[model samples]
Target: MRLLATAAVITLSSIAVAPALAQTMPVAPSVLPDGTLLDVTATGKTTRVPDLATIRAGVVTQAATAAAALSDNANRMSAVLSALKQAGIQPRDIATANVSLQPQYRYEDNKPPVITGYQATNNVSIRFRNIAKSGAILDALVAQGANQIDGPNLSLDQPDAALDEARVDAVKRAQARAQLYAKAAGLSVSRILTIAEGGEIAGPPPPMPVYRMAAAKAADTQVMPGESDVTVTITVRFLLK
Candidate 1:
């Protein structure tokens, strides 16, 4: 489990914060017979290729009236959904992210803004487990009246295991550093007194623009999710004899 609280307290505050279900007590060294205390902070990271992709596909339409704009958006969005299903996307991986209707206005030099037409947008967020086929699916979506394509944000499908591995690496590095310090001080390492961890830092790549079919009709869209780094940092207290 990830350590939410940095200081390990046996008892939590009377008014504990939500989401942090449990508190871990810091270990206290029972014996301190002639020893020096040392604190070591170390960070470890691991790189892995992202296994999942996220894309926002949407239909945008403008008409004279709100009802007409909405109606047109709904019809085109329905076709987009059908195209997604036809491309082997699962129902669970597809979700409606946004639906909005706003008035398009034209601004004049010396007069109040004039309402031109109503613009309707319906967007769906799709998770592609198969990164290889994500590009093709995005192209298909564009062909089916989907004009607004926002992202191809690549990320890991499962990060828990990778994070755990990083934690273990961090602990090992801390131990190694502690040993080095003990040797430098002409003392042997004894035991650990406490261990605290900062928040994990794992971030995906920034969003990339996926071109619509009109501008790039010559070729199929391609997605290249390079790699991401998962890092864990830990501070450990050591006793040296």
Candidate 2:
């Protein structure tokens, strides 16, 4: 009875070990009889109209002390915000993007730099839903003590439809490439193994013709909003049989 119990224990251990060894084996890709490798890539693109404008404007102030510099920046920014609001900008449309106060430094030969004064900055982001009013709003802000301005990044408010269109185009391109490969190999396209898409919208700033604004009768700062383009690219892989 002792011998039979020992034999049964050995058999059970062997059975458990066999399954683990099998599970450790690596999976290999399927191979065709003719040794033909299947690979294909596709690309697609689409364009979209822009519907929104984002502008970055700010007030920069420098004074003998940090408190004085900050106070000056605050007063100038207040005027700028008021101008934007009077121009029909909503509260949500205006946001304080950044506020920074740093000490100014003056370096002398062979001596450590000394803090001369403090420079304070307050930047605001403005979204112009009404594109037509963008130029006037910018002018008003500048007139109200806003010294720094950057961007007016034009873009579409919603880009879902454009992306969908680009996706379909990409898949179609992948299918066409797969079909070409399969035809050459005397086989046929079977299924899509994988599909991936990545793209970004590019919006360069509109050329701002500088204006002296010496008088109200000065020629208005002419702004021409040319067409904006939305670009999309995708990669797709198809299986051939």
Candidate 3:
């Protein structure tokens, strides 16, 4: 009987002590001894010539009836697609951007608006891998039936290399700034706590001249893809000794 009683007391005591041990456990320190944290943000930029261009071309047609307007737009749009294919543009590179039909309105002085005619519009966005021939392709589109042309938004197909270069520059700048600040404070950089990339910023493409197809034989449009800047920002944290 005495042995059984002692065993029960021992088990109860162990259970009580387990909770106490857990409550008194040590946690890792979030900061070092007398540590000073430094945060610096630096931007790096590099320029590269764009290799790809995205062109938006479409046809706008007007007729007295909705069916007539839609039929006319379809026919014109078909010609534009055919021209793009003839220029070595694959089907995967072309996509329909927008298609809409709306009623035109004319307002008279102090009178209700009148429905003038129906207008139909169809637009497609084309990706040109060979930017050298893009200008000629645009000219061909105009010769076909494309009346409205928007842009050849120039860009790089693979920007990873350029972005990596920018990142390296950013880190170098950050380290330089951190070292300067640390020296002014009579401290040395102990270790890097963390490095976080903010993001990459791509500069806008150069403006394109808008074109209206008035004649079948329009001069070949000249496309100049200027240099574009790729920028990167990095935030670094360092622990000072």
Candidate topping lDDT: 1
> lDDT tens digits, residues 112-207, model 2?
999999999999999888776787788888899999988766655676676566557666766776677678667676675555453433334454
Better of 1 and 2 by lDDT: 1
Local accuracy by lDDT, each model: 0.74, 0.65, 0.73
By TM-score, the best candidate is 3
TM-score of each: 0.77, 0.75, 0.79
Candidates 2 and 3: which is better by TM-score? 3
lDDT by residue for model 1 over 106-206, one digit each (tens)?
99899999999999999999999998888888888888899998777776777677767777987888888878777866777789778777546535444
- Which of candidates 1 and 3 is the stronger one according to TM-score? 3
Which 10-residue window of candidate 2 scores lowest in summed lDDT?
6-15
A best-first ranking of the candidates according to their TM-score comes to 3, 1, 2
User: What lDDT, from 0 to 1, does candidate 2 have?
Assistant: 0.65
Residue pairs with backbone overlap in model 1:
none
